[model samples]
Every structure is written in C-alpha cells, then in structure tokens.
Target: MNPRLLLAIYLAITLAPLGLSAFSGRPARSLWDELASGAGMLAYAIILAEFLLSGRFRSISRRIGMDVTMRFHQLFARSALVFALLHPFLYRAPSKPPYPWDTTRQLTLTDDLSAIASGVAAWLLLTPLVLQAIGRDRLDMRYEVWRLMHGLGAAAVAALLLHHTLAAGRYSADPVLAAVWIGLFAIALASLLSIYLVKPVLKRMRPWVVDSVRPVAARTWEVTLAPRGHGGLRYLAGQFAWLNIGHGPASLFENPFSISSAPAAGNRVAFIIKELGDFTRTVGRIRPGTPAYLDAPHGHLCVAGRDEPGIALIAGGVGIAPLLGILRQLRLDRDPRPTLLAYGNRVAEQIVCRDEIDDLARHHGTRVIHALQEPPPGWTGHSGMLDAAFFRDHLADPGMREWLFVICGPPAMMDAAETALIGLGVPARQIICERFRYD
Candidate 1:
C-alpha cells in the first residue's frame, strides 16, 4: 500500500475514539473535563496501536519502511505518555459519589477507588516505560532483558488502561464505545502473541544451519546460513532479518542485520555484521553448522520494480552491506543501467570485500569511488568527508536527476549524503534509504 494511505488509515484509527466520544449524547461537561477525557482516550488508543507498530508486522513495516514504523512507534509512545500524565490533572469536577438528583454523574466525577488506582498505576508506569526505551542504550542491561521488560511493562499498562477506561470513563459506559475499547485492547494482545509465540513456532519448523563465518572487514564478520530441511528465505536485495544463532527458536537473543548476499545467489543467506552489540561481538566465533533461526525479509530498501535509468549507491563503513547485495544482484542479472558506488570509510581496512567492489568496477563497468577520512599515504581516492562538496565534485551529471540513489550507512553519513543529494537535484522520492536506529 502507499505510505500516504497507510498514514491516513493510522490517523483515522487513532482519532476514532475522540470522534465516538463527541457523539455519545451525554450531558456536556466543562472544556477541561472534556479535554481530559479526550486525552485519556487518545492516549490509550495510541498505546494500543503501539503494540501493532512494534509487532514487526511485515504489512505495515514493508510498505512504510521498518525505520519509519519503529520511529512512529517511539514517537507515539511519548505522545501517549504526555496525554496519560495530564489526564487526571485536567479534570475540573469534584470527586464524589453520585447523588440521587444527578444520575448521569454530571455534577461530580466518579471517586471509585479501584478505577482511580488502575489509572494511577498506568500513568506511573508510562513515564519510566518511555524513558527507559528512549535511553535503552545507556541502561546497564542486556538487550534481550530490556526487550522482555519493555514488552511486559507495556502489556500491564494496556490492561490497566482498559480497566480504568471502562470503569470510569463517561462515554465508555455506552455499549458501542465500550466495545471499541475492548476490541482494540484484544487486538493489541493478539499482536504481541503473534510475535512472541506464533512467529517463533513457525521459525522452529523451518530451521537453518550456519554455513560459514569469516572476517569481511575491520571488526566485521560474514555469517552464512543455509536452510536445514527446506528452501531458504525469499527476499529482495536490501532487506534484513532477525537472526538467532545457537539459541532456541523462542529466544530473545536475536539481532537484526542486513542480508549482504544477493537474492540470485541461491537459498543460502548471508549477513555482514559489525562487532557492536553483545551478540554481534561473538559473530566471529560462530562455528559452521550451528543451528539458527531467521525472522527475515523485512525492509523497504529495495529497487527491483523501479524504472530509474541509472543507479547510484552511497555507503559508509559497514553500511555497505546492503548495497553490496543490490550491486551483486544487478551484476548477476546483467543489468544495463549505469551504476556508481561512493563508499566512505575512516580507513581502507574498514572497507569490506574491497576486491569484489573493485571487480565490479573492472569487470561490470560500475563507477566506483572510494573515500577515506584517514587515508593512507599515496591514496588516490577522495581524502575528505562525503559532504555536499564531495557529491558536487563527483556526482554532478545531467542524467543523475532521473537515476535512483540508494544509501545505507551511519546516521551522520546518511544525513549528509541525503542533504547533498537533494541539493544536487536528485528527487527525494527517487532516493531509497533506511536507518538502523529507531530513537
């Protein structure tokens, strides 16, 4: 589906509760009271939607890019936190039991102890939940442990919110509105189950075994996996997968990495991973024939269906992994489109598969440009950062406006390259890119 249409659907789903509340036909309360209720409803709705967004649903992530999906998940979580925090404080009505004359509780807010307790619990849990996610890297915790805590914490908050809303909300007393809340909450739980239980079971049925693990560049290793008893992953050139090696299928020790091997290179899948995280640091030691499981083919950094006249690939350090997949596929298919690769690294040793990249230039007619920040003596390639000036010097061509530009790299390098490419007259829509970080 189109990204814009997906966004529109998201807007509708998030705002549905607000719209439903407006037409509930209840006695109108003060602006503050209504705003408080609306905020609470909006917050809970967004929180429920967060589950689906983070559930790794290919339908959503594949269409909008997993980076964008995860980004929305984080931002929406923060927004829900703000709304939930302000929900109680915004109420202007006095907290008291319902009087005989005021059956609709118009003159007073419900002082139900259990309802308020649940709401308070959810509110308190939300702040630290979002804060921990935003600063997850700084926390002295394992990635798998943090992921477990985050998931359980979110589920608890959702349950508390559901109880608080149905028990205390003015509009939620209505059957239609109450059903909506219940339905959304159920869907959220289902999404969680699908990820943690269903997908793992499916992956367990189709296991893979490690084929090889070897050094590709500085602090980087290439790990290959071949299907144990079935055909392997069917994926595009630049997609990624969550790989769990030498672990149970249901384990949370997996890490996402781009598929560096070409799709045309048979069923054996490969990943180019750098030594960054705990699991990644052990990639060098992963022995051949170790059992592995993959949750794969998730990403939008592919250009298979595009009609661009030419292709330009910009990569930084290990970010060259996915671009290598794309280049290799193009070569295997004997693509006639002009190709250019601008690969930048701090040192020449950091360049992965340098001979293969150069071979693409020598044998396949790819225009390869290498940039080294700390270049060795007598180096001939660019000797500075890949900024706008570097792009203008090497990428200034009349036909480039219609070409497709694919970039994968560090955040700083991707940002600079994007800005430079746009400034150099490359249309933003024609530029395909994906980030590794969500926060």
Candidate 2:
C-alpha cells in the first residue's frame, strides 16, 4: 500500500488504454483525429480512477493520507473535465461515406447516432457533476444527498461513456481494448460496492450502542459508544471513524470523527464533535444506548511506532480530537517522551476537556499551552491566532526537529504551521498534520 506503488498503478492503468489505442494497427488517420481520440480515452480512464481515489479505500487514502488522496481526486477530476471538454473539438474530420477505393475509412468519424447520443449525454452529465463537486460546500443540500447524487451521476456518466467508446471508437473496435474498458468499469463498480455494501454489511454484524453524550465545550459534545457484542475497536491513536448514530448499517447518515479516547480506554470509544453540520448539532439530544454503526480505524496521523524523544501536539478548536487520543495513549503507556500541547480556541469556553488536558500535564509531564483569540481579562497563556509567529516563538528548540509534531487545525493555521516548521529547519517527514475541513 505504498503511495508510490498506488501512483504507479494509477499511471499504468490510465496510460495503458492510450498505448493500446496507438498500437491498435488501425489505418493511419489525421494527427488531429488521433489526438481527439487519445484525449477522450485518457479522460475516461481518469474518470473511472476517481472512484478508487474517493477515499473509500484504505489502501489509497490511509497510505497517502486522506487529504492527499482527496486533493488528487479533485485534481484528476478537473484533468478529466479538461480532456473531455476538448475531446470532440480536437477532431479535424467529420463522418463521410467511404470512397470505393478506401477500405479502412480513416478519413471519416463514426456517424452512429446511438454512439453520438451517448457521448453527448456523458458530456452534458459530466459538466454539472464536476461543477457540483467543486461547489459542494457552497450548496445548501445535505452531505448525504450530495454524496448519493454524486455517486449516481458518476455511474451514469461512466456507463454512457462506455457505450460511446465501444460503439464509436476506432481502437475500441478491437476486442482486447473493449474488454479493457469493461474491466476498468467493473473495477469502479466493485470499489463502490465494497465501500457502500460490503463494509456496511460487516458493520451491521457487530453493532454498537451509545453510552453517553455530554457537552464538553462550547457547541461541542463528547459522545461515547460501546460495542454491543464484539470487543471494542482496536485502532491506533489519532485515527478516525465514520459514526452512524441511530442509523442503519446501510444508511449514509454517518459522519467521520477522530477518536478522542485512547485505545487503553478499552471498547468504550469516544468522539469530540462540534456543531458543524445538521447531524452534529443534535449530538446532545441522542439518548443513551442508541444503536450505532462504525466503519472505523481510518487515518494515519498516529505515532505508535515513532522513535522520537518528544511529541508536540498542536490543535485548533475541535481539531484536538485525534491529538487527545494520542496524548492519552502516551499517558496510558507511561511513555517517557517530552510532550507539549498547544491548543487554541477563539474563546475560553471553546476549550474542550480543559481539566483533563491540564491533568495530563501534571501527571504525565505534558506541557499544555492554551491560546485564546479573545482571552478573558489578564489572561497570560498566549493570545490571538496560532500564526507563524507563535510557532517560531514556542517550538524553536534545536532538538525539536527530532520530535514528532502532530498538528490538526483549520487550513490557514495548518498552512502557517507547515511554513513555519520548514522555516525552522524541521523536515516535513517529522510533522504529521490532518486538516479538519472536509471539503
């Protein structure tokens, strides 16, 4: 599941169709016509690859990190859009009746109305699909609704494009290439089925029940759950899970949340979620023992096997969820590493588990530093945003580069910290960061 291996596989699958088309032994066509076909073929392959890159697969997302996987998905989608948009326009010739002497009809494009209709339909459908994904956050629809629509739209577009390719494509007339397209489409379907169907069915066999939901901070609640029959989740610290509280295993009503409690805390897993969405705003209303489902142990932000002598845990607002799990695990293991926690919130009330974080500092030797943008009167712990200045002033020790710096926060703060870390001569590999923004 190495990132390089996944990338190599991606390039091979995407380019193989183009290679096969080029060597399909078809009669020579105009360069522009060949280029047009190449664009369409490449675009289609990339479009199909997007399903695997959707972060539903642990091999892709966990290996490369969810943020990187998602970013690649977005980029590949746009690339496919560009190629698809120009696919038809790049052609130089129109369909014409083959001359009596011409056997291959290389001068004419496919004039099949059925094939053309499918292509047109795919083209029309893909435009809004890409646009909707780009503007997903701006839309007012529920996340689950958007997710379902995106999946269905993608499937329709893929199906239409497949028909158009097999029917209209010069190289796709070859049996081998046609089968390759079918195989790629099948893989896409299998990936979706694995995520949507297989995983859900497995989660249903070992369901969970909510233990409690209590307000821990401003607009934030600590929701805990216990496995109904199975031994609790065995995930590493700093990982996350998709929790479906009171929702069926097959339902798309789950949301991803980082595990806030340590693995040593046993099967009773906990999550610190804020009121960011419609489902989360009602976290406090869920009664005890509500049936829940978990598709969990995702993410790669943990430090279980690290060789660092120290740990720097920096978080912003609710981004502290995963980092708390890391810190708590370190405490439970009686780890001797020097630890520093820099937690920031807009106001004092937004600080989650303040007493517990402070207790980790006293009992486990973790230096818990809290930063408030709007600190109360005569507050002394650091103020304003966790900008580059804060990182430079606080984490500038020479030996700091040897420590693992785990950071999760708003995009701006994470960016600033990354820049500051590089400026401080810390290698990028020494830093672990997860962005809280889903979009």
Candidate 3:
C-alpha cells in the first residue's frame, strides 16, 4: 500500500469520531456528541504524540516525502492557540452579579482571578507562537531564542490546557476519554522531561572527550570527538549529530552538525562546524581532550536505498558537509554511479574541502563545477551566482527530469536553484532539498 494511503487511514481512525459528530442531530449529552468530543480529544492526543515521539515523527515525515513535519508543527501550534482561545469562552459561564468588594463580581470556572491569570498566560504563549511562525525572520530572533521560546510556549499551553480540561469537567465526565487525555499529557510531559532533564544528567556521567579542532577555513572548523569509553554513536554517512561543548550532558546548547567523516573511517566522529552562533564561534577555543557530549546520527540525507541512474549535488557553504559525507561513502563503497557536484561559494578561498572534492571527482569519474560569486584575478572557474542560465548551459538534456537533484544551501540559494529547476519544467518530485537552519 502507498505510505500516504496508510497515513490517511490512520488519520481517519483517529479523527472519524469528530466527523461523525458533525453529522449527528442530537444534543451535547447524546452518544454521538460524546463520541465526537472523545475523537476530538484523540486528535489532540495524536498531535501531542507527534511532538513527543521524535523517531516516529522523523519516519513519517520522511515517508511522506515532503517537509510535512515542520508544516504539521506549525499547524498544530496554530490549532492549539485557537483551542486556547475557545476553551476559556466555552468552559467559563457568564459572570454573575454579586454584592462583593467592588463593582461587578465576575464568576469564573475557577476563581475569576485564577481564570484571568491562566488566560493571560495562555495568551502570552500562543501570541508568540503565532508571531514566530508568521514573522520569524522579521523578529531577528536567533535560532536559540526561537527554540527556547517554543519550549516555554509549549509548557505554558500544556499547563493552561490541563487547567481547562480539569475545570470544564465535561470531557472528564467520560472516564475513557479522561484517561486517554491524562495518558497523552503524561507521555508528552515525560518525553520533554527526558529530553531536557534526564538526557543531560546522563551526559554529565558519560561525557565524550574532544580530541582535536582543525580549521577547514576561517569560518569553518572540524571538531573531532572520542567517547570516554565505547566512543560516541556509530552513524552512517550523510547523518548529523548535535554537539554540546561547554554545557552539561543534557544542556540544550547543543547544535546539529553533519558528520564530515565517513562511518567506515573508524570510531572517532568529526563534525564540520560553521560559525553560526555563540556556541559554534567558541568551538575553536576549547582545548583538545575537553569533555563534551553528543546527540547524534539524525537526519534522512542518505542514499542507502536510492536507485537513481545519476545523482546531482548542489551545495552552498557549510551545506556541503552532508554532501561530503555522501561522497566519502560512495568512494569507500566503490560505487560507479555517475555523480555531479555544483558547489557555490562566496569566494574561491571559502570553498571548503576543495582538494578532497577534486580527488573524489578524479577517482570516481564525477564532475565538479565550482560556482563562485567573487573569483580572484587569476581564477579561471565559473563566476557569478548559480541561476537558470547556469543550469541551462551546464545541465544535459534540458527536458529530462529523471535524474535526482539533491540541494542543500542557504535559504536564498536553495530558493534560486529550486526556482530555476521548476522554471526549466522539472517535476517537483524530482527535486529533493534539505534546509540546514538550526531551528
């Protein structure tokens, strides 16, 4: 069966109750209404599960073959905000006039003051989530800030949601639905606690030692790590690992870095780090053998099971890290499939792993095309940014869309390349891209 078909079936099973309720012509106390309400709770539970289960989320997103995970995250957050707004209005009865201390004594689900406080908290959380999703770039908020805010917002929403669930008493009136809601909340809480608390504690106990830091360029550094005992995680090529240098084992300061070295190279793992933030900028400052922790081997950028006749890699800056790993894997595996690399850099000097790329091209019969914005006086390679004209000139058979195109780069470059390909009549399914933003 098609993976998408299975996903549709799963969604129907989880949300059919709500659909059934919409068609029922009965009061709130009727069985159909109760079933619909229960199904609504179940749908929310599924959303919560999606946020908690990292493995399942990754698998499903990869299977769907789109950036559905991120889209779902945005959708779930927006829906939660809407629910937060509706929960207060629906659950709380209108204020009753009473001769209290002041003008009009407003009655609430909980005490009026407590209800107001929780509502304010929920608003504070939901507002930022909506703003961040809509205007993330305009806010100039750093990736770390965004991540921290997302976590805080999720916690606040969960707390307010729990308060509403308990105070309303309608959903809780149904024992099974209440139990399912509680179970879902418990799982979300536990998963978050494990990631934030337990994981760091474990890392403090078993920290990997940083062996060396080598400069690949002025802005890029390769940090090597050796596990204290059994070594860090064993990962395939084209995978990424999060590195926490100065923080404790469970610290959220970790940043994802692609494994620059191939897995076949041995026990030590190396990450090619670009100076993108405070954590990455200080990477070169840490002395060799300093204790560190890694959470790794994530991402689905591998070509393990792919059977394409040819592969084309388009990379910009540090986005080349995963492509490098893929190339190294191909070299080690001795695969003779034709490959082409179109690497873009600001200047000739900023081109990373140039020698290694050239060597791979020579050995594996791959073609390397260097596209630079500013080539030096003596430079002879292609100049200017990669655009439609560039692809039109270099790519063979302008109409054929069968070849796989793997793109990884800065947002603008990736957008340009994607636009160029689509303008040339390339099918959307034929183009695969990986956005490398940390958040």
Candidate 4:
C-alpha cells in the first residue's frame, strides 16, 4: 500500500473513538468510550515516543509530518494541557450538598490545585518550544545548554503528567486505557534511559578507536573511525549516525553526522565535518586512536526504492553531504539511470566534493551543473542562483515530469527550488526534499 494512504488509515483507526464521541448523546460509559479514551492516550504516548527517540528536532518534525516539529509540538502540548485541565471539571462527582451549584463550586475550587501544577509543567515545556520556534536565530544558547534545558523541561512535564494521570484515575479505570497510557510512558522512559544510561554503559564496555583524522578543507576535516575489535555499523547511503568522542557516554556531547562514504564498504566510516561552531571546531584536534561510540544508520533519505527514469539533485552548501552518499551508492549499485546535479555554492572555492562530482559525471554518465553565486574573473561555469530559467534551460524534457527531483539545501533554497519546480509544472508527488533545519 502507498505509505501516505497507510498513514491515513492508521490515523483514522487511532482517532475513530473521539470522532464517534461527538455523536453520542450519553456520557461516556460503554466499552466504546473506554476504547476511545484508550486510543487517545496511546496517541499521546506515540507523540512522546517519537520525540524522545529522535536524535534531532528536524528528524522528529519530519516523522510527525511538519516543516518545523517544535511548532507542532508546542501547539499539541498546549492542546493536551487544555484537555487535561477540562477533563476533571467535566467528569467530577457531585458533593454532599447534592446541589448542582455546590458541585460546580467544589470542582472549581479543587481543580485549580491540580490544574496549576500541570499548567506550570506544560508552560515550562511550551516556553522553550515557542522560544526556539520564534527566536532560533536570536536566542544564541549553546547547543549543549539548549539540549539540557529541553531534556530537563520534558522530564518535568512527564512527571507532572504522570501525577495528573494517577490523581484522576477514572480514565485509568478501564484496563485498556490504563494499559495504553502506562505502555506509552514505559516506552518513552525506556527509550530515554537506554540512550542516557544503557547505551553509555555499553559504549564504555566496548568502544571504537578513531583510526585517523585528515583535514579536508580550511574548516572541514574527514574523521576516519574503525571498530576496535568488532566490525562497525552497516549503514545505507544518505543515512546519519550519532557520534560521541569521549571515554564514557556521560560526556553529554553527541551529535549526528551523515556518512560520506558508500555503504558497500564496511568496518570503517568517514564523516566530513565542517567547523560551524564550537563542537565541530574541536573535532579535528581530537587525538588519533581516541575511543568513539557511534549509534547510527538512521534517516529515510535514500534512492534505493525510487524507480524514476531520471533524477535531478538540487543541493546548496553542506546540504550536498547526503547527496554525495546517494551518488556513491548509485555508482556502487551500478545503476545507470540518468542523473543531473545542480550544485550551488556562494563561490567557486566553496564548492565541496568538486573533483568527485566531476569524476562522477565523466565515469557514470551523470551531468553536473555548478551554479556559483559569485564567480571569480576566470570562472567559466554557470553563474547566478538556480531559478525557473535554469531548470527550463537544462532539463532534457521539462514537460515529461518523469524525473524525480531530489532537493537538499538551506530552507530558503529548498523552498525556492520547490516553488520553481512547481511553477515549471512538476507534480508535487514527483518532487522529494529533505529539511535539515533543527530549530
């Protein structure tokens, strides 16, 4: 079945109970109500699971089908807070006075205590999410600081949510609902604990030795790692792995980087690191043979299942990292489908993997179009940004729409390329892009 259709079906199944509630005249009492409540709990649990398991915000956002996952997270979290607040008010029992006014007064008076605690927790979680969404550029918190705050705030919310759930156990009275809620909590806790504790313990027990580190460019370096004794992870092209360059997992500094090599080659992996900030700037200086731990082979950006007759890759800056992996995989797989790459860089000197790209064009029948924003005096390649005119001129058959356009770039560049492709009559389904922005 089509993945989108399957997702739709799954969502419908998960939300069917809530949909039926609007039509039901009586208050929730039957098995159907229990089922609906159970499903809702399960959905919330799934959301938490997806968030905690993700290595980065971008990955979580994509998993949840949003351009910015944090925005959706804030919206959903606030909505959950509202639902949680109203839950008791709508279902509380009457007081001894037996008067409706008395019951209302009693609920209003006591609800604030539980509501305030959960509200505070929800606000703590929502504040960072909203700030990150709106002030990503302005709030210059270090990555480590931001990560610590995010994790701690999430834990606070989870603990408060647990308290709220247990305090009002009506929802948990139904075994199915209780089980789903507890199961979700357990999964999220276990996933986080595994990442924070178990994985680190194992890494300490067995670690990989960094074989060598070679400077590739002014600020970029290529780090080659080999498993100490056991073979390393088996990964596909366009997939990323998390790296921790320390003795124990307690270091609290782990980042995801794409594997710049073909997957067919085993036991060793190469990561092309560019020093954009503090974490990466020190990468090259790490001593050779230092112990490193990697948790890897993640990401859905690959051309393995794509059967399009032609492929067009649009890349900008370091976004070309994954595309390099894809190209290498295509070569290793011996797939000769016509591939066109429109790689854009600010200047000629910044064009990464220039030699490899040119070599691919020469040997694999691929065509590479280099778009330089500011060409030097002696430059002869295409100049200016990639727009509608560029696509109209270079694409072999613009009207065919049989080509798969794979775009990876800065958010603005990706948006522009997508719009230009759409304006040129490419169907939405035929265009594929990856968003790597974390904030």
Candidate 5:
C-alpha cells in the first residue's frame, strides 16, 4: 500500500498495452503514426484505470490519502482528454480501407462505420465529462445527480473506447493485444459493480438510527447516530464516513463528514456539520430514530501509532470537526504527550465547543490558542488571520519542528498555514492535511 508501489502499479497497467503493441511484430509505420497510436492507447488505458481511482477503494486511497488521490484523479482526467481529443487529428496519411496487400494495416486506418462511430462518440463525450466535474459546485445540479452522471458517463466512454480499440487499432488486431484490452475493460466494469451493487448490499445488514441533532454553533449542528441491530462503527478518531439519513443503503443521498466524537465516547458516533447545502440546512429537522446508513472509516488523519513527542491540532471554522475527535481521544486515553490547539474563527459565536476546549487547556495541559478575525471588545487572545505572523509568533519554538501537525480548513487558510510551517523549517512529511474538495 506504499504510495510508490501504487504508482508503480499504475504506470505498469497504463503503459503495458503500449509496450506490447510496440513489440507486436507489426510492420512499422511513420514516426507520427506511431506517436498517434501511442497517445490513443495510453489514454484508453488511463480511462479504464479511472474506475479504481474513484476514492472509494481503500487499498488505493488509504495509502495515497484522499486529498492526493482525488487531486491526481482530476489532473489525470484532463491529461487523458487531451490525448483522446487529438487522437484522430494526429494522423497525416490518407484515410482508407485496409487493402489485400497490407494485412498488418501498415498503410491504412480502419474505415468501417462501426469502428469510427464508437471512437467519435467517445471523443465527443469526454469533453463534457471533464468540464462538468471541474464546474460541479457552480453547476445547477445536486451533488448526487452530478455523481451519478459522472459514473454513468465514465462507463459509457470506457465501453466505447474498448470497442474502438479492438476494432480499429492496428496492433490490437493481434490476439494477445486484444485480450489485454478485454481483461482491463472487465476489471474496470467490475470496480463499478463493487461500488454500486456489492458495497450497498453489505451496508444493508448494519443499519443505523439518528440518536440526536442539535445546534452546536452558528449554522452548525451536531448529529449523533447509534447502531440499530449491530455493533457501532469501529473507526479511528480523525476518520470520516458517508452518511445517508432517511434513505436506503443503496441510495446516493449521502455526504462525507468527519467524526466529531472519539471512539472512546461509547457506541454512538457524532458529526459536526455546518449548514452549507439544501440537505444540510435540514439537519435540525431530522428526528431522532430516523433510519440511516454509513460507509465509514474512510480517511487517513489519525495519529494512533506515531512516535512524535508532541501533537498540534490546527483548525479553521468547521474544519475543527475531526481535530476535536483527536483531542477527545487523547484525553480519554490519558495520553501524556504535550498538545497544542490553535483554533481560528471569524467571530465569537462561531467558536464551537468553546468551554470544552478551555477545559482541555485547564485540565489536560492542552495549550489552546483562539484566533478570531472579528474578535469582540477587549479581545486578549491572538487576533487577525492564521497568517505567517501568527504561525511565527506561536509555533516558532524549536520543538514544533518535530511535532505532528494536523490541519483542516478553507483552502486559502490551509495553504497559508502550510507555507508558514514549511518556511519555519518544518518537514513536509511532518504536516498532515485532508482536503475534501478536489477543486
């Protein structure tokens, strides 16, 4: 599950077809002709590989981290789109049917309508697919609807590319190369089946019920869930899950949220949710005992077995959800490692669990520092943004370089904090971040 090993596997899978085709013993074409085929073949394999990089597969995401996995997914999709779009336009030779003299297709491209149509369909579909994903938040569509469209559209593109490759590709005419395309396509389809059919069926056996829902801070609610007929989720403190309320296990009405409560708090699980969407704004209306389902323990933000001498938890607004779980877990276990919490907010009302955080400082020796951009009268704690000045003033201590730094917040704040930390001589690996929005 090492990141390097995963990347090696990916390159092997994506480039294997190209390598095989180059050595297929076919008659050589012009250099541009070979490059054209290489571009298309690599793009096709990358498209099929997209199925496994959906962020649902633990074997891949757990090692690379969801943030990196999703970022790679978006960036790689654009790369494939470029290659596919220019595929047909790259050829310089005249388009013609295969002749009796050239059995290996050294001088001709496939001219059959079936083969050409599939390629054209895939080429046209790849454009909107990438564009929609890039503009998902701005588009006038529900997240679930967009997710469905993405999955179905990707499947359609992959299927068309499969037919196009087997029927029109010169090297793919070989039996060995043809089998590789079919096998990879089958693996791609199977990954979709696992996400939609197989995982949902398993979730039905362990349903959950809404235990409670109440206001925690401005426009934020704390929702709790308990197992209905099974043991509750066995997850680490800083992990997350996809929660579906009043929906069947197979439904797409789910959102990913971090666990705000520690595992030591008992069988129930809690989430700190901010009202940012249509479904989230209805959180206070959800009644206790409503049916729910969870696809959980899906993040790599935990520090359970780390050897670091100290830990630092940095938060910005609702990003404090998972960090609270980590702090609570450390307190419950009577962990003696020194801890520091630097929580930032826009105003006083937005500082959630204020008293509890203060208690951690008083009782557990947690150095809690509150930074407010819009502090009230007579503000004594750190004020202004969590900028380089704030990081230098509080975390310039030599010991901070060795502590594990966990951060989650708005993209801008997270970027500033990371930059400040690195500039202050902290190693990149010592800092951990989890970004939910691939954008």
Candidate 6:
C-alpha cells in the first residue's frame, strides 16, 4: 500500500486503546488523572507498535522504503518516551488505596505496590534505551552487542508496561482493553522471535558460499556469494541485503550492503563494500568458500515498473553499488529508455569499475558524466562536487524533468541532488532515493 494508507493503519492501531478507554463507561476522574492514563496508554501502544517497525518486515518497508520506515521508528520512539516520562507527573489524584465505597477507584489512584514498581522500572529503562539509540555511534560498543542489548531492553520494558497497565490502569479492568493490551504485547514478542529466532533457522537451510573477494577501488572490495543449494535470491535491481559471511546465521555480525550484481547475471550475488570500520574492515580477508547468509532485497530503490522515457542515475563514491545493479539490469534487458549516469568520487582512484562504466557509454549509448573533487593533471571530467550547480549545468533539459531519477551517495550529496531535481521541476514521485543512515 501507499505511505498514506500505511500511516492511516498505523494511526488506527496506536490510537485504538485510547479510543476504547474513552468510551468504556467508567466514571470519569479528574482531568489530570485522565490525561495521565491517556499518556500511559498511548505510550504503551506506540512502544508495542515499534516492534513491527524494526525494518525487518518487508510488507511494511517495501512501499515506504526501509530508510523511511526506520525514520518513523526512531521518531515514534522519541514521542513515546516523552509520553511515558510525563505520565506520572500528570496525575492529580492521590496515590492511595481505593476507599471501600469508591470501588471504581475514581477518587484515588491504584496503590498496588508491585504495579507501581513495574511502571517505575519501565519508566527508568526507557530513557536509557532511547539515549543509547540516539547516541549509538558515539558509544564504544560493537554493533552486535548493542543490537542484543537493545532487543532485550525493549522486551523488558514492554513486559513491565503490560503488567503495570493491567494491574494499575482504571480502564484496563474492562475485559476488552485487557485483551487488547495482551494481544499487542504478544504480537510484539512474536515479532522479536521472528527476527532473532525464526529467520536465522531459515537462513541456515538455504545458505550461500563465498565465491570471490577482491579489491575493486580505493578501500573498496567486491564480494560475491553463490547459493549452495537452492535458487539464489530473487530481488529487483537497486536493492540491498544484510550480509553475514563466515558466521553462523544466529550471529549478529551481519551488515547491510547493496547488490552490485544485476539480477539477470545468474544466481551469484555481488556486493560493493567500502571499508570504514567494524565488520567492513575485514572484507578483504574473507576467503572463497566461506559460508554466507543474506536477509535481502529490503529497499524500494528499484525502477521495475516505472514508465519514464529515460532513467537518470546519480552516485557518489561506493554508493554506486545499487545504481550499478540498475545500470547492468537495464543493459541486460536491452531497455530502450535513454540512460544517464552522473557518478562522482573524491579522487580518480576511488572511481570503481571504470572500464565497465566507460563501456556503457561507448557501446550502449548512455550519457556518462564523471565528477572528481581532486582531479589528476589533464583530467577531462568535471572537477568539482556534484552539487546543485553540477546538476543544473548537465541536467537542465526539460525532457529530463520527466525522466525517473535514482540517487544513492553521501548523505549531503543525495540531499543536494534531490533538492536540485525538484528545483529543476522533476516531480517528487519520479525521484527515488534511500539513505543508509536514518540520523
């Protein structure tokens, strides 16, 4: 479904509890007390819904793009945190046992100690959980370790919130709301199990073996994997996967990388990896025949059904991985749409697959423009960043405005390219882009 429909569904799910509680026929409490309950219920709903937004479910991410899905996950998490933090402070009712005559507890908040403790624990844990996510890159921890901690921590908070809500919440005494809370909590836990348990088991059954690992450009390596038994991954071009090589399926060592190989190029898949740190730094040492696993085809960067008269590809540095797959697929299909590639790098040596790129322009009638920040002596390509000026100078044709534009690169460059395309009159629908980082 489209993003608007997805968003509507999300709103319906998250607001269901509040809507139910509002109409549950319970005697109304003080305004502050009602706001407190509403805040707590809304926060819990958003938190549970977060489980499904973890960027693993293809059904949710396929239409919105994984990056956009993740962006939603992060933003909703912060909003939930705010509501949770304010829940306690918003209450105006006294924290005491319900009077014998006040059986409904409308005059006093629930005084159940265990329920109160659970709420406080969840409240405390949530702050650190959100902080760690926000400052993930600044922390001195392995990504794998962080992932495990995050999953366990979130599960703990969810459990605590469920117990606190069922025991202390006024509206939750109603059977329907209680069931809703339990159902949501169960779905959250099930989502965790599917990601951390079920998917690994499936990966083990259909494994891949390393076919080759070789340096392709400055600090970049091209790694290929061939299916050991089953048919290889069937994915559209310009998509990515979480790759785990020389590690068990259960391990958290997997890192996401784009497929540089065309889907039409047999079953073996290729990744263009630029080493920055962590798992990537060891890409060059991976040997042939090592075991590999893929959780793949996760991005909405493909142009499969687009009917634009032409295709424009923009890339910066190793970000060209997915774009290269698009270019190769187009060539293999003998697509008649005119193509343009504007690839940029910091230096000449950083340019990858130079010969193949040249061949596309020389033999396939593609318009290829290369840009370099620091050019060598007598360099003929454009000698500057691929900024607004570069796009304006090379891509101002009115016909180009109607063409489909796909861009992947450094965050800044991608933003500039997107803005420039819009400034040049390209419809937002015709431009496809995905960021590797949500922040």
| Backbone clashes (count) for model 6 | 0
TM-score of each: 0.98, 0.98, 0.81, 0.78, 0.98, 0.99
For candidate 3, which ten residues in a row score worst on lDDT? 102-111
What is the descending lDDT order? 6, 1, 5, 2, 3, 4
lDDT of each: 0.92, 0.90, 0.67, 0.65, 0.90, 0.94
- The collision pairs in model 1 are none
Question: In candidate 2, what are the lDDT values of residues 1-439, reduced to their tens digit?
Answer: 9988999999999998998977888887888988898999999999999988984677777765788888889999999999999999999987765667765668787777998999999999999999999998899999999999999999999999999999888889889999999999999988888878899899989999999998889889999998998988888999999889988999989888999999997889999999976898788899998999998888889999989889999999999999999999999999998999999999999999988988998899999889999999999999988888898889988889888889998888888888998899889999988753645
After the best TM-score superposition of candidate 3, give how far the Cα of residue 245 lies from its true spot, in angstroms: 1.4
Q: What is the lDDT of candidate 2?
A: 0.90
User: What is candidate 1's local distance difference test score?
Assistant: 0.92
Which sections of candidate 5 miss by over 4 Å? Answer: none
Steric collisions counted per model = 0, 0, 1, 0, 0, 0
TM-score, cand. 3 vs. native: 0.81
Local lDDT at 42 for model 3:
49
Q: In angstroms, give how far residue 99 of model 4 lies from its true place.
A: 7.2
RMSD of each: 1.0, 1.3, 5.7, 5.4, 1.0, 0.8
lDDT of 1 by residue, 229-287 (tens): 89988999999999899999999999889999999999999899999879887889989
Cα error, residue 14 of model 5, in Å, equals 0.5
Best by TM-score: 6
Our tally of clashes for model 1 stands at 0
Overall local distance difference test of candidate 4: 0.65
- Candidate 3 backbone collisions, by pair: 200-250
The Cα error of candidate 6 at residue 375, in Å, is 0.5
